[model samples]
Target: MSRQTFLEPFNAKAMSYAEVARTFVPSTKFTQLAGAWNSVLVGPRGGGKTTLFKMLSVEGQEAWTGAAAEPYKQTVAYTGVYVPSDIAWGTMLESLIEAGQDETVGILFSEAAFVTHVLLSVAIGIDRHVALNPVLRLEPGAETATDEPTQADLERVIATIARLWKVQPVSLSPASLVDALRERLLNIKRDTRLRAKLKLTDTPTQEYLGIDMLESASQALQAFDAAYRRPHHRWCLLLDEFEVAPMHLQKTVLAAMRASGAQKLLLKVALAPCGPDLLYDQQGSAPPSQNNDVQQVQLWYADKTEAIEFCQQVFLSRSSIYPALAGKMPSEVFGTSAYAVVDDSEDAAQIDLFTLTGRNKKQVTEQFQALAEKDPTFQEFLRRKQIDVSRELGMQPSDRHGNTLRKIAPLVAFRNAYKGKSVGKKRGVKPFNTAYSGWESIAAISEGNPRWLIGLITRIMSNNDQVQFPVPTPQQTAGVQWNCQRYAEMLQSVANEQFGSIKTSTPIYDVLSKIGDYFHNRLVTATFVEDPPMSFVVDERVSDDVEHALRIAVNHGAIVCYQIAADVGGFPTLRGLRFRLTYLLAPVFKLPMRKSKSVSLSTILEAKPETPTSQDDPTANPAGQLIQGDLWAN
Candidate 1:
């Protein structure tokens, strides 16, 4: 048999038994979330929010918990149900709010409309589960729920749903009942002609439907006996992509979870760090405290160490299921260094094309030396840079450039390597190579996102329809880069082009472009400035439109934020927070990807172009300080 390539069995989509167990690496946050049972899981897209939810879902997949949260298994207690976001379905809701309806009534009406939608999703999920698994226990003794549930079972489900509205039956089947409610919910959200139907049902005892409806649905899950593990069995709602849902819905859902009255129900929601929208309630009177009603857990990587461990663990776990690689370490199968980067260099990418196109250090150095000896043009440029450096240091230019060129040949060779030979004409040329490797580079390339990281690695292993053990070979790197680059480009496009009439895009694009330009030519290059503005800060008090724009930028991963008071040297003057254009856009600009240099928004807005002060008065502030004149003397 051939050597093993550690292939990942699961993507975001399908999963088999062995694949699930082999690829699962438990995280601390997931454990805490499972133990706490009610939480808001927040992070950027591909930060493993959806994957975590998928693993934790209670769909006859017990012990689905990862290793980190072990010994404390995600209890077979909660009947965990996954609810997908329907931003498509939210349009009608948005229209209603804009129709000049009373804000208070609109909020209430929207609550009913949204709650009904959640309930319907849950019912259909449960219905399908029981329908497919006929031998599974649904309730008391009925384990025979086939593709078609018995009318008696249907009656029970109907009664359970009736308890949700707290009213008489609607005489609809499980499918019909869901279809009926979905139609009305849509009507309430968008149909101006049916605008009168926005209010709570008059037949339901004049009761206004709220999250209690979801609570009732949670309680109803117990009817499927498989959902029950022991007494005090719990039910959880895994709310994914909570950020994209309307702002009010995010607040409303959290508040609803607080008032759910289903003490056993857990709230597992995913969120993004868009500050203002999450800072306060609808009344704007109070901010939601993290420790109080709902626990907030972030899934973003804090550092390279953690990111590498995660990536390594994932590789090992996925490899374990491969028959040929059953008990091998990741390093044994795939060497730790897939990337060829300079060690301890401030700029790793300063290497030559020979080093870039798939050559190890020894081979790259030999090639560079051969080129330097053969090519007069290569020698000339090296000598020119040498003379410049020699003059700067006031040193004699006898052999400094000559010595420098050979010692760090790759660094200088890149600018003129083409003069020596047609690189690919030599037969068997290697593809691109990066300067760094291991988890940090992988994490950097992934922009600290797990989904793309996982997908990229999976694609690498699956190259040539063979298990790509030892290494993915240079051919697979392009495919891997393509996916990462695609995600990065998507974020920029959203920030730039404003897909889907999202208004927040342009402001973010404008601010980032403005910041990028100023930094490249001004702040970073200015020699006399101390504590130069590194990133722009946005005050919380900014207009709602600006806040909305910033929220979109952050939520969509176009910008990464540093919370005021939380970060060292945080925005002292700005009441809100600061943001930097996400380094994920580094590839698009062909610039070295580095963390943003922070500057305050106030600084950017208030800045006046400096007028040069001549040597006549070198002490004058370039800002043109105002002179204080004595008014009494005048």
Candidate 2:
């Protein structure tokens, strides 16, 4: 399918298994489930965790059921449950009630009897209502039943359950009532089975309410599972938005499920990266050690290949679903393409389409060429449009476009065209250009942190039509500049928010500035060491600043810390955690340091002398030369 047609309804719904699987094949961590695992998958939001989980669950279900497919399938018994942490408590309560009814058998007679009695009353009431008036619906009202008791009459029957159990009045809470019901149901079982185990009497009244409730609830769910007939045999509890659950409750729920040894029951949870911290903080608990059973996995940026492939699959799936523009190039309309060209060389030909674009190069040159052909005058138009837009926006006319300006060109064009038509001075202050500008900058900076990328894109797209171009008056010009500056300021703001105060007295700023300078100076050929402690190098001019910033950054844990090696030629050179900061900072600030070591500044400043002299003084080196005729020649 063509790219343009495919993305027509992109991201409108959940993606298909094939499409998502194309983006991210299940990793070892995803596939390696030998037994029950208390796994916490963590990643930046929108980094495809949901997609991954969905794919895994579906695949697991398929494997368990031995469902027919073109290829042979594996048979396994696994139930996948997704419980968003937010509603975990209610779900747990519900599951408990279900389990209790299912597992109520011979041992716990009183608990089981209570559950049986409640079921019997409900059944008898329901049957009576059905027999008396077949079409009548059981609608509960405040008044007592005058004619036939409705299914709504079941409430009274359920409420009367307290008397049979010799218990306190049941609370109005649904969960509480469910708990109470489960407890009453379990009384018989507890009296018979648990009586001997706990050395107690086999009487419903003698059973502890809490234990009965818990045990009955567990058994009911088990029983329900055994009786149910479905192809996907196991039951799954999906927990969505898990971050909402209080930390203690999250732990409690997890602990309960773990203790149950309820095979064929799976717990799937969704939580933001911040969820863990919130859980820990609310519970006033220490962070779990690495060896702890509750494993946390963060959803981070995909390798370049994965991201590009994801983009491709998204475009393809959309195109297939939508018929219009079915055969055309997708990237042409979107200003980006997932299509890549292959060279004849074996090694080059073997490269995966996704990684080639992500790692080796971002520009789809052939696609760009095709787009250029679509609009023969596009390049010229873009240049002229940029100049006109820049003038209208009150930016200085310059031969070069800064990365920020170039990146936000589309936004500026759209905003400028929009503002040109609006006629009211009272239309409120023109939307800041930086609103869109900042997003593009962040994309370049973050290297496609999917959450941040999606967030920025969503934010800009929502305001795409609304952003206006104000006439460049003196005040408006200043406003535009202010907005531009503020866009840059966001990096610092976000950093500060995440890491706390970035004091000038600290070395972080110095290192950042130096790193910035280094990139500005050496626009190409920058490298970083990946091992701990990480360190970087650029031109010597910025070295001191970079060192200081590194120190501060390390101290604050802004980055994985590293140190520079003193010796350049030592084995395992550049030992430390190092990454090229140039990739991040170059688009923001263009530094002015010279890259060539051979070009000395002194040579450029020196003038030719009228006469030459051989200066062979004992103090002077033989290589030194002096001007003879004039001592101070200009």
Candidate 3:
């Protein structure tokens, strides 16, 4: 397959079972997920939540390679059944509720349809495991692989589940039983759709109503265990797209997940970080507590080391398919680091002098002097460390082993290199001041999301099939900007529905665009602003409309937020929240891809908005005294 051919699987849901398993790359979180505990796999969209959930299934395990797969296969005590939620289908189920007589009956009908889909997946998963175990040897214990159940035993188990699920099979075989379950689901959908279409006011009902979803699932697993001769075999129910599931159903599933330990069932649900509904079913009722009842495994790539390593592994794995990229590392293709030192007289495109260390003595001495002379903040930083800016820089001083100055040299080089140069359009539109590139920058911009990383890498590699390793800085910058533009377009369209009702509704894109401009002014355009605001904290008294807008922005990945205050359920209360724009758009806004201290959101919104202008008193505020106290306050 070509490099482009391999890129399709980056959208993990679109790939087949075998394809996903074949191309799977395991990360540290995979080990955490493979355990028997009930875990909520939380991350932004395209952060590989679906991929990880799919890998837990039997097919994924069967096609998995390397030393990692063997240990996981040999010792795993549970069989994974992957149940992917379809939002469209869930929406249909929700519509069906309106056709019912009362709210209680409506929910009953909706839950029945949802569970029918779940049960069908469970049956299908068991069938695949049974048929493939003999050849794949994924089952625990060496003898268990060859100990295939007799046709009669399998048929009896199928019959028992069919009866428990209130479905009659056309035949006493696994495939036939699956067909019956599918038909059952189809019938319910057909009935609901018909009622909804005719606007039926009569009491609506489903044949499978009142069947406890958890009880049926538990009983079905027991029947399968008895038939397979493994009396205590565990089942890991890998539920993907938990946020798409109806609100009531999510609560029920979460409640069941909390109590699943004694039932020999392990539930691992994959969901987006933020959603409209709280996980709790009742307003005042306590929700399932994290750590004590459930394990919350976040895949946000907050740890730079882990995210960088995983990005490298994914690059290597995906690039192996193309002959030109076979032996290349990300550094070899995207450049060694995000920033490099060059001669003070040169531009970013002048790459012959580029060095990752940023310690070329002449360049460092010249760049340091230029920045210190123009901006007094840099000079003060130097004075505080008692470092002579005129001296030729070679290495970190013994006296300042862990000091930030030595580490910030490369950043200084970058800041000086593009001080006033227009590299590309600002935020992919207006004339921008600088470009973000390099292997480390790409990884940071991805924010540990595999989809974003893959998109950026593919954009870089797709245009040049025969492109050589160590791609030039200019080409990398172009590709990064292109990727940023793509995401910027999407961000513009988000939150349209949530803001549709308000006459003065602010499009999320406009809000972020305004904020991005503000950040650009503080970080790059201003003369001598120190410790610019890279993020912001919201006050608790935000209007409901604005809070809802913010929540929608968060769920859509335009804004990345972290909770500071927690309730009994360990969920954030959306109060005093700290957040930053999604770094994938860093190139668009001409901002650095680093997280820093926050300022107040209200201050930014209240301040007179202004486009960034680089011609201001270039060196007047040498001590950062001109910076607004409330605008950049920690």
Going through the candidates in order, what is the number of backbone clashes in each? 11, 68, 3
| Candidate scoring better on lDDT of 1 and 3 | 3
Please name the candidate that would achieve the greatest TM-score relative to the true structure. Answer: 3
Residue by residue across 324-436, what tens digits does model 1's lDDT show?
66887655554443232222232222222122232454454454455555544445644656434222211112444433433343233321222224321112223223422
Cα displacement (angstroms), candidate 1, residue 437, comes to 6.2
**lDDT accuracy of residue 547 in candidate 2:** 35
Per-candidate local distance difference test: 0.49, 0.33, 0.66
Task: Sort the predicted structures by lDDT, highest score first.
Answer: 3, 1, 2
Cα-based TM-score, every candidate: 0.62, 0.37, 0.83
- Comparison by TM-score, 1 against 2, better one: 1
Span of ten consecutive residues with least summed lDDT in model 2: 525-534
Q: Which stretches of candidate 3 lie over 4 Å from their true place?
A: 1-3, 6-9, 93-101, 133-148, 201-205, 279-285, 338-361, 372-388, 394-402, 410-435, 498-504, 525-530, 562-572, 611-634
- Residue-level lDDT of model 2, residues 224-247, one tens digit each, is 333232223443343445444544
Residue 94's C-alpha lDDT in candidate 3? 54
Model 2 per-residue lDDT at 619: 22
